[model samples]
Target: MRILWTTLLMACAAACTQPANKSVPETIEPDEAHIALAETLTPADPTLAPIYDRSCRACHALDGLGAPLTGHAAAWAPRLEERGMEGLLGSIHAGRGAMPSMGYCADCTDDNFRALIEFMSTEGQS
Candidate 1:
């Protein structure tokens, strides 16, 4: 009985510590082309464009920074669905993760944040 219990424990430990499959990458990095394109993406609305450029673009447009890449619907979908608009705005207001408070847009109103969120969360934006 003691031998059987020891064997089971050893088996469980070995199984738990086995390295993850190398065939599946832990993180898929975006290529340079995608990064370049992300850099140029902006909100279509002129009013929102500057704000996005100044405040949101730096982190949101880049990959591997923990911020969701702008215009990536799949990345933004779970956040939007889970938090809804108001909760997202609250995150911006209070700052979440690497994002600064109010997303670094000091003068932006709730409406501005709403529009910016809409633009960033959408796909196929120019």
Candidate 2:
């Protein structure tokens, strides 16, 4: 029946539409020291540094973006523990929350992602 088809189409359309306001996770307020430290930190690897600067730094280094700050082991600890390297890589590939797919690094290989994760998760990196 025409009415039945219309109802099905309407339901499908409604289901496909995304809500205007998406609920975001609570973000921590970063202190000046944390901001300064995050800004200064970079991956030790020369190849990875550029990739990090271009892709990950913008969100990961700052707080209030729902991303863990660089050099903040506590923030990253739970994530690392819950999702191991492979799981974390899956998040990056799938794009979690505000982060874009491949973490905005289309050219990055698995090894590159692993290195970047290690650098960001570690506490004492210059």
Candidate 3:
């Protein structure tokens, strides 16, 4: 009876410890083309101005300085260069610092997050 109990415990532990399948869920891959769009920004992109105005500007500041200014390239440069585009996108989507997820931009899509990060980094001294 003890041996049977031990076997049952081991089986339960194995089941609990097992790693989920690698492709069990969907994965998001940042699109480079989306980042490129930020480089040649225009006021016409209604989403950009509004997103910044309504949501991000409060914390990140009007000039991307709300939490801290975007003027300091050194601050954002390393994160951008080291983490790369995908990493930045994930951070934005996931939130960081005093920033809440989505930066309060409820309708933010992958393209939108990529665009915002690119916009913030593009003006960087880097």
* lDDT tens digits, residue span 1-126, model 3: 544643553454346443333322122111343234333343236768777667665654333223433333233444554456788778777887767887898887888877766665544321
Point to the candidate with the largest lDDT. Answer: 2
lDDT of 2 by residue, 1-126 (tens): 544643553454346444322232134345567778898898888999999999999999876788888886555645654566888999999999999999889999999999998889776585
How many residue pairs clash in all the candidates, one count each?
Answer: 0, 0, 7
RMSD of each: 13.1, 14.9, 17.1
Model 2, residue 69: distance off in Å is 0.8
Instruction: State the weakest 10-residue window (summed lDDT) of model 2.
Output: 19-28
For model 1, the stretches where C-alpha displacement exceeds 4 angstroms are 1-34
TM-score of each: 0.72, 0.74, 0.54
Q: Per-residue CA lDDT of candidate 1, range 1-126, in tens?
A: 534643553454346443333332222344555567677798879999999999999898988898877766555655654567898999999999888899889999999999998888776586
Model 2 residue 10 CA deviation in Å: 51
The order of the candidates by TM-score, greatest first, is 2, 1, 3
Q: In terms of TM-score, which candidate is strongest? A: 2
Q: Rank the candidates by lDDT, best first.
A: 2, 1, 3
